[model samples]
Target: MSALQVGLAVAGGLLLGGVIAWETWNARRRAPRQPVPERRPPAPEEGERVEPGVASALPTADDERLEPGFDTAPGALSPLGPVPAPEKRPRLDALIDVIAPIALDGRVVSGDAALAALPATRRVGSKPFAVEGRNVLTEEWEFPIAGQRYDALQAGVQLANRTGPLNEIEYSEYVMKAQHFADALGGAPEFPDMLHEVARARELDEFAATHDAQLSFTLRARLTAWSPGFVHQQAARLGFTAGAIPGRMVLPAEEPGLPPVLGLVFDPRAALSEDPEQSAINSLALSLDVPQVHRNARPFGRLRDVAFALAEVMDGEITDDTGQPLRTEMIDKIGQDLAQLYDTLDAHDLAAGSPQARRLFS
Candidate 1:
């Protein structure tokens, strides 16, 4: 071959190799990253302890080194003043329950007699069933207590839940349970028209399906992966504590009985691992169930703040399920939309975070 031709061939070979190398580099960069095993951290250092708290807001967002204040007496949270006893869940509401009134014919029924007449289980098919008695003196409807006297009785079954709308089978089951209980107490029971009530369930389910909203953001490690202990320690500084489930943390509501305001979750496997520090967790999740939390608690805002705060301290990036970066504009827009949702729920008599709304949404 001519000398000029040989030189051109050599130049072309080098250029082709360079192009392949560049493409490979870009591919690796774009691919999702895996977790890197982490080592155990040192003991606590000189710092302010993060006080354990959960409510409308944390004491302060910037504080680090938060710790749970334990009561020497009963292991209760002390800083919050003995962690008030969890409040009783609210009673059934007619708006969400298919109620059946039982006429006792002026017979004074003992609480024990009523309790004995209750169904073997409180559930009628997929819905929750409750029986309330009208106290003779107080004139209030409540569950039968062992020693109380009641003049009237009523039973109710939930209309809808996460499982779906009430159907023929469930409504029938409710009727049977109510009838059996009323017969034992010698009370005449009256239930709504089944078909009509079932229709109401469908409509309510439709509204719920359209309005139900839950938000989640995944935080992927930007450099080094996190260990379970590391994740817990960092979140504790922000007033989060170990939640009921493994690998989950919760920001508690100020109201003892209310559902948590927000959740922080990581890989369960890592949390359960024998050597948690050696188990790498590449991603974490933050979530909010809008209807479960009260609007005054500002759940969405708290979730946003916690997400960004954790990302900054942990050297991570907040992304969607697909790992795409979640932009600030999108997050802000969600907050605005949530505000509108809260208003709609309020208009429907199921305000966000209210007991009635919580039960219906459940």
Candidate 2:
């Protein structure tokens, strides 16, 4: 109730209010707050100024296009562009490089005559010897064996492995044979390096590997529809002889030292009926296995003719491996391809179906 007591109470209340306000302000200042994020500049447009060493990291329009014959993966860049593949060589060519030829001269007689006079008992390695011929009137001789005729005068006898290179023993035996032939002909024996010939052979072999092709024509019929005797008769008319196998008939090679190019195959395992009139043939396959280096157009033409004849006689359709009917245009196209191959071989002085080609390609 005293005036001094009332004034003391008011001062106490005022002091309490001021202390509470100060405490609230201190709590708010100590509380944690979220952090602010940083911002980056926008990328420059094409032709715009960019920092040095930074432009190389950016992609260009050409990076999206791929080079020819090149394969690329997604999200990856190839450091080097497409590279060409290396060429392949034949195994025989490398083997022939170490070989040399042993030559025996025929003084007065022809090379062929001297070669033919050689003793049958004499063995000059497993490989056959090739004879080089010269004109009786002129001293010059043909370079290629194909251009020379069988009746040409014999000048020298060469014991070399035209098909493959000779080994140590084989080379020694060939040298011995050359010496013997030289003594018989009363002339000196000479040895020549075959590096040039070996190089030519290699080129021919590579060409063959690139262009080799095989064609087959098949005729299918119901089971027990062709008799073996009838098939043999038909084949005989087409100049086909029974092969080593019972069901196989092969066309004879046009020249000696060459293998058969075409063959007729029949299924001999088919059931046979007791009736003589019934047929026992199942299927017939006509195949032309042409040599890559020595093939000519004649073989392909003959093959087509024989296929047509057999198809007509058997009352069957000619088809490919996929059983699709073969059209005449397809066969004509094959013939054209064969002609082109022959021309290419001839241009390189390696005529197809020639004796030299046969010997080298063998």
Per-residue accuracy of model 1 over 168-268 as CA lDDT, tens digit each: 99999999999999999899999999999999999998898888988999999996778888788767756788998899998887767778878899899
- Regions of model 1 farther than 4 Å from truth: 1-87
Q: In every candidate, how many clashes are there?
A: 5, 5
**Model 2: per-residue lDDT, tens digit, 67-142?**
2222111112124222111112111122222322223332345545555546554334545543344444555543
Shift in Å, residue 357, candidate 2: 3.4
Instruction: Write down the TM-score of every candidate.
Output: 0.78, 0.48
The best candidate by TM-score is 1
The residue ranges of model 2 lying beyond 4 angstroms of the native Cα positions read 1-126, 132-173, 184-186, 194-200, 209-214, 222-224, 234-262, 267-279, 289-298, 320-330
Q: TM-score of predicted model 2?
A: 0.48
Predicted structure 1, TM vs. truth? 0.78
